[model samples]
Every structure is written in structure tokens, then in C-alpha cells.
Target: MEKMPAKQYEMGSSTSTKSMQPQKFLHSKRIGHMDSFSRHEMMYDPPSMESKSMPRSSYFNSSKPWPDLESDESDMENEIDIDNLPPIEVGPHEHRLQYTYWLWFSRKGTHRATDYSKSLRVVGRCASVQQWWSLYSHLKRPTALHPYRDLSLFKQGIKPMWEDPANSKGGQWVIRLRKNQIDRAWENVCMAMLGEQFLVGDEICGVVLTTRSPECSLSVWNRTATDHASTTRIRDTLRRILNIPVSVPMEYKIHCDSLKYVAISKGPLKS
Candidate 1:
């Protein structure tokens, strides 16, 4: 009366097994249910919303933690501020020069006598740096100068003529600045002279600025025409400081030699 029958026990065991199997499968199947799917999506790919709808601090404010949108946004704003900032001024070496140009009008080969007279009437001797700029700022660019027009710049004490005692025996390291290179070329010339970058130093009598057809000219003058050492140093220094391109050629000429070349090349009357 107390023991259960074997058949009855078997029936109970089979029924329990069938119920347990279905129960196990229910968990997996239920994962696709709406709430379960929502949970899954929340953990994975949630919908995107406009950044503006959230607290402004969520993106830019500095006061939050975890997903500190505030700090992030503030950082981004700061980055934009930095990016939009005006350029910082560095020292001279970091900056490219914006040059001021001077124009010269010569009565002889440079221009017609009438034009020379007009320029002379309007031109005043510019002795100081400020005065030079005042004169230069109003003048035409080098490339715009007349084909026959010549422009020259000399130190305060110096004149453009070779006969000037300071220049009489002097030589020049000449770079013919093509019309296209007027800006950089003229800047280099001005930097060299004003900075006194020439190795010849005192041998540096002055500089000459001339604009002619097809080119503008910048010449570094030395005190001694026959001083080969000074002339060599001058030319080498120019080659280095100007960072002159290898494709372009340069020439060094003694004033005496230049005069001779002019005589032979242009004719006796021109010389």
C-alpha cells in the first residue's frame, strides 16, 4: 500500500521531462518579445537625437561627469576658439617680410628727359627709414616702371654714381631680378642692405636698386673694386643669404669693368 507502481513512476518522469524541455525553450523564444527587444536595442544601437535637445552642458558645459557632454562641448568650443584665433606673431625669422619699394627715375637711359624732370620735381630726398617708406608706399611697383626707367637706392651718405669716391673703385655683386621675382628679390636686397648682412661689412659701400626692361636689378656695392677678396666674400654671402635658386645665374662685376662693358656693349655715347 505504501510503494508506488513502476509504471506510475515512469509516467510521472516522462511528463516532467516534457514540461522542463518546453520551459527551457521559452527563455530563448521570449528574447524576441517587445520588451526584450527594447532592452537589447538599448544596449546596442539606440536611436540618434539632435545634440541641441540635450542639456547644453551635455556637450559643452564643464560641470558633468561620466558622459560629460558639458566638458566635451566646452572642449569643442575651446577648440573652435583656438582654431578661429588670429595668427600669433612670431619673431622676424618666423615671418615673411612685406617689403616697401622705392622708385628712381634717371634722366639718361632710364626715361625720357620730360619724365625725368617730372619725377625730379615730385621726388624728395628720403634720408631716414620712415621717410623712405613714406616715399616708397606711394610709388608704382617695380614691374610697372617704364622699360627704360631706372631706379637706384643708396645709403644715406652714398650716391648712385660710380664716380662717388666711395664707389669709384668699388665692385658689385649683382643679381638681375626678373620682373616676376620683383617681390622676393627686392625683399632680399632690402634685408641684406638694412640688416648689413654682407660679409664685406665696411666694404659694403651701398646698394643700388634699378628697374629696367624685362628685369629689376639689385646690386651690392663694395668700397674697393680691385679687392678680389672683398668681392668674392660679397658674392658668396649674397648667394647664401638670398637663397638664390641654382637655375638662375648671377654675375659679379667691377665698376670699372662694368663701365668698360657698357662702353663696348652699348656704345661710346651710352658709356
Candidate 2:
């Protein structure tokens, strides 16, 4: 499929055009991790004292524990059942997006440092506009999610974590929004990212919507915090896309600073 020119996404232009035909791109069926409910059921047993004493680094190990491995495989088996769900019909001509994106969900764990990665799960993936809508339509609105829950839409292959290789040297533009503003703001940012409206090329990593008590926040992750020009463009483009007023504060926090904070909070490393 021919890529749509970046010019097509310039400010003030409509995101979609009549000339763009939906190209047939294969949708990846491997949605990572199970839904929160199923995962919670599988992990009902309390953490053992031995497990708690294990080095914190072990929790982030690339290898999965036996029970988690079993649940992961079972979740893969259920992907076949997706076709049975209520159909979200798209015409033969679907609008192919510039890049495939994955949706991820996470809930804060009892331990802030470790629970995050353990709770992270891939909700679904989409390569075209129709598929994105199909996945999104089935999800509860941001307003419905409980506090401490996060919904992120990231480019495929990039995990929404500070330690991920793509994100390790980067930072994010964070914008806090009122409870009532989340739904519209989240949709607008996702559409902007998928449409390549940021114009930062591959520098743009993903967008996240985090729900919290009384307020919610959205963050746009990028590949480099040192590239002032690109980062500035992203911040400006984000403001334009979200139509956020100047009064609403936007905070930029580097991943390294965040890592330092985590390390300090966790205290000295155990031998």
C-alpha cells in the first residue's frame, strides 16, 4: 500500500480523504496478556513469603512463571473466538493507517514498583482505521475505568514502559485533564497519533490515558528528550490537536529522572 504523504496530515486539514483507499493489511491476532478479570482469577492465591523475599529484579525477568505462562497460552487460544463477537462491519474499502498500533491496559498493583509491569496487558491491535474502531468500540470509555487504571495506544513492538529500549532515552509530554474531558481528549490524541499529525516521524512512540481520582491525564511519549526541536514540535502539535488551552499546564519528565525517583523510593538495592 502506498503511504499517505505527511503533508496530508497538516493542521486544519481533515484527517481522512476520499482518495485514500483502505489497503488490505493483515491484522495480528496475537493480543498479549489476558483481560484483568481472567488474570485476577488465575492469580487468586496470595503471594507467598518466599516469593516476597525474592529479589525485586526477578519480578521483571523476561521468563514468565509457570502459572502465568499457562494463562498466556490460554489467552492466545481465545483469540479465535473474536470472530463470534458482534460484527463491526467495514466496507471493502477500509482506510489503512500509516502504522499498526497496539492497545494496552494496566492497573496499579499493591506494590507500585513491581505491579505495573505485571499488570500490563495488550488489549488488541489494529492496522487500519476500521480495525481500530472495532477494537475501541468494544472498550469501556476512559470515564468508566477505575482510578489507577491506564489505557495506552502505542505503535506495535513498543511496550509502554520507561525501560523499553525505544523509550529509555526519551520522555513524555503530560497533560492533566478534568474527569469530564477524558473521553474526547483521549480520542483526539489517538486519532492525531494514528494520522501522523505530530509530524515528528518515528520519534513519536505512543499516547497514554491514565485515570485517577478527581482527574485524568494524557501523555505522549517520544524517542528523545535531548532533541529539543522535535520535542518542542511534539508539545506544540499536541496542544493544537487536543485544543488544550495555555492555562492547562503541560509537564515534561525524562525517563532517567523517573528511574531515579523509583530507585530512591525503593531504597538501596538488596544484594
Candidate 3:
């Protein structure tokens, strides 16, 4: 096939920065079982004790920094051949995640939205490890996205919007990085989510990734920011998963705050 049409996003325009040193975390239960991602059949089972061991290396290692997404003169230099690359997940399994997730994309920023609902588009949905990897492999990394463009993966029926009932009471943990260095952090965060390492049970709603000049941020949304116990666990788990350094701050914002401020960044940036 001729070289693929020019990709819509461009990465590596600026120097990269390393994330924080991740604290050592004890391994949690391996992802045990789940139902399919079909909208109607979505059901998550209770965590099982029959947890499998996933080598630290299989996912991101808290000990090391992740690779940066950079390219000079060509997209091929940054592209990974999906067909030839090793599978992030191997084969069909007997289990699935508790909920099917849908990936949403939008170049429209909060500034462009006459209607928040109309600005975003659903890219696809996934319920299995293989399925998640397949979807991710086809998409551009967060770093490749233009400033203000965002990618959000939320539970099947839950739109990324704060207005969604499932997310209305919740808040998100934000990880900020330089524009071209978001892929590694983005990958590790998604893997940890898809792997069910948060141990917050079904409290997790989904995650959103957005890029801006000088900063690319990924945020994990959970059901109740008021539930301090669950939210704290989610926050700390995210820190280790993303290997966020202590020097870099992580912000928490209630969905209600978004509605109040009418600016997505305001919620997170508010005190």
C-alpha cells in the first residue's frame, strides 16, 4: 500500500519532560473476569480471588520513564505497524471488564462548544483486553493530537460529559505532561485502568486525555469525589500507575465544578 494519508496530528514539536518517581506499590488483584462490551449486555462481576500475575514489565514499570512520542520529517518514524507488532493482549479470554468502554474524540475545545454534547464523537467501544488494545493501536497517541483535541474513554453508557448521571457526583485525578511526552504516560494509565488495578471496584467511570501547548494532561474519572476513601485510593493508585513525580501536582475536580465554572480547566485548576 502507498504511504498512508498524512496523519491528522503531529507530535514532538517540543522538548520532553520526565514524570515523577513512582512510589512502590504492592500488586493488586489481577484482572479476573468481566462481561462483554455490548451496550445491553454490559455487566461486571465481583472481583475473584483467582487473580493471575502480570509481570511488571508487561505493563509500565514504575521504576523507569516511558518513551516519548517524537518525529522529525516523517510519520513513519513515529508509527508502529499494528499488524506486525506484538499483541498487547494475546487471545480471547473467558473473562471481560465489568463494563464496556467507549472511546470519544473531539477537536472542539470548551471554547468552541456551542453544545458540549454535539462537539464530541464516539470513536468506538471495547470490553476486552484484546479489544482495547486494538482500538488504541489504531489511534494517534495523545502527544500526536493538536492542541485542544482530546480523547476520552468512558464506560459504555456514560458520556464523558459531566452532565452524565454516572459521573455527576464524581471527580478526576489529573496528570500533566509536556505536549510530546504524553504517550507513555497515557499508555500506562490506560493499561492500569483496563487491567483493573485501581481496586476501587466499579467506582471508575473512565479516563480523558487532552493536549495543549506545553502540557498534555490525562485524567481518571471516578463515581464519587465525596467518597473520600474511594477517591483517595483512586488518586494514590493513579500516582503510581502514571509514575507521577512528587514535584508535579495532581488536581481533583468535581463534575459539579465544571458546570459551575463552565470551563473544563477551571475545575481542576480551582484551588
Candidate 4:
């Protein structure tokens, strides 16, 4: 893939692109913790307790619309006697992605005192369709996590924090939603990123999900803060794919300003 030149934003710049790949960005560039005013709209939840020791069905939410994973497929075309049945074959059916991505889990705002660098954990890395689904299926949903926890997804080797080299000059588009709103929106954004449906260049780095008591925010980090054209392209794609209501408000901010002003500032950050 051809690398695109990223736009750099100095400290205190107002212009930034809108995004929702989520945990929050464009507002906390330094990385120990995220500012409330962080920009984004996508959400993810950590793996369920059982997922770690023993993988379980990914769809833990009883309210989930789809049928259970076990019973969806049935009825074979050919029939054979039990005594002489043909042996099954195992082949490589996994679908591959352009980049191997990593999923991160942490409790950023819920326990502000905890060290962000230390708490961030990589659940796993995936480069194939089967691998992605296997990882996602075992994890818990956003609604299942504690209000203070967060989830993030990014390309392998790229940390989701604002201070990471890949994200320093970039910004994100943030989307805020009530606790009840993260389900479908989260899934949509994941699919979009994995599918590379955003239509922009390699500008997108990753996305994050931050959950607080009352609501949560989803943010998508891009590689540039001043590339207005590319940023707008991503924003439009996000808007269309997310089906965000016209009435909902969106905001953009740069990592430099976020790090310099949002973080290390005494004032309370906005969600």
C-alpha cells in the first residue's frame, strides 16, 4: 500500500477531522489518560471472563438479534451410511485482511488513578476472517463491561494511545452516545474498518471505545490532523455507514491540542 502524507497540527490548532473509531482522541495526545472532550464514536468491549480461560460464544448478549452460533447451519446435500461415512477434511478457509490488527482492553476513566500504559492489554492479533470472528465471538460486548472500561482496535504494532508515533500528528472524529446506543454502532464501525470501507487512504490508524457511568464515546484515529480533504472523506463515510442522525452533533480535534491542552489541564474534560 502507498503511504499518504499526513498533515501535522501544532499545539492549540482548532481544525481537526471528525471520526469514531473510539476510546477518544484529538483531545488527549500525551496518553496517560483521555480527556472528556476527546473526539470519537465507535465502541468495543473487552472479552468476557470466560473468554480468557475458555472461549465461549461471542454473542453473550441475549438481546442480540441473530440466532445462536451453534444452530444456524443445517442439512447436508449428500447422505451416507453411518458405518461407511466419508471422512471430513480440514482446509485453510480463513479470510485474510490487508493488515493484521490488534484489540486492546483497559479501564482508563473508570479508575483514573491507574497507569494507562500499564493497564492497556492486547487481547490478540488477527489477520484472517476466521481469526477475527474467533476473537470477536469470544469477547464480551460493550454493554457487558464496567462503566469505566474501554476497548480499542488498531493495526498490529500500532498502540492505540495518542502519544504513539503513528498517532502524534493525527486527530479523530468523536461520536457520543448514551449507554444503550453502542451495540449496533460498534459492530458497524468494526466491519467498516476491517473491510476498509471508509474509502479514504491509509489515513485511519485505529478506533477506541470509552465507557463512563452515563454514556460513552467512540473515536476513530487517523494519521493526519490537517489533511482536510482526506479527513472529510472519512467523516462522510462514517456518517453514511453509521447512519448517524442529522440532529446528532459531531466534533473534531487534533492530538497536539488534546495532549497539550486537554491532558495536563486541571479543568474537567467533556464527554
Q: Give candidate 1's error at residue 244 in angstroms.
A: 1.5
Each candidate structure's TM-score, on Cα atoms with residue i matched to residue i, is: 0.49, 0.65, 0.62, 0.63
TM-score of 1: 0.49
Indicate the TM-score of model 4.
Answer: 0.63
Candidate 2, which segments miss by more than 4 Å at Cα? 1-92, 110-112, 269-271
Error of 2 at 10 (Å): 25
lDDT of 2 by residue, 71-90 (tens): 43533432322223232333
Question: Which clashing pairs does model 2 show?
Answer: 22-94
Tens digit of per-residue lDDT, candidate 4, span 1-271: 1122232111112312232222232122422122121123112232342444432222121222322212213112111122332222222654456677877776554234424665565554566555565577666778777777778999866888778898999998877766666755676577678767776747899888878777777788898888888888777776766665444446776888877864556567668
Q: Give the lDDT of residue 55 in candidate 3.
A: 24
Candidate 4 residue spans exceeding 4 A from truth = 1-91, 109-114, 262-271
Each prediction's RMSD over C-alphas, in Å, is 36.2, 15.7, 15.0, 16.6
Report lDDT (Cα) of residue 126, candidate 2. 71
Which whole-number lDDT from 0 to 100 does residue 269 have in model 1? Answer: 57
Please list the C-alpha lDDT of all candidates, in the order they appear: 0.45, 0.62, 0.58, 0.59
Residue 162 lDDT, candidate 4, scale 0-100: 78
Compared with the true structure, the alpha-carbon lDDT of candidate 4 equals: 0.59
- Compose the digit string of candidate 3's lDDT tens values, residues 1-271: 0111222223232212332111111121222211123322222232222322322223322222222222221223222222342323324553465666777766654434547775565554566654555455556656667787778988767888888899988888766676655776676667677667777878999989987777677888998978889887887776565554444445787888777667554455656
lDDT by residue for model 1 over 1-271, one digit each (tens)? 0111212011112112222221231233322322212323212211131222332132223333222212324333333221222332223322112222223345343244323332221122332333333334444555665555445655534556665677877777667666655544554455455444554556776666666665566777778867777776677666665565444455666677655655575554542
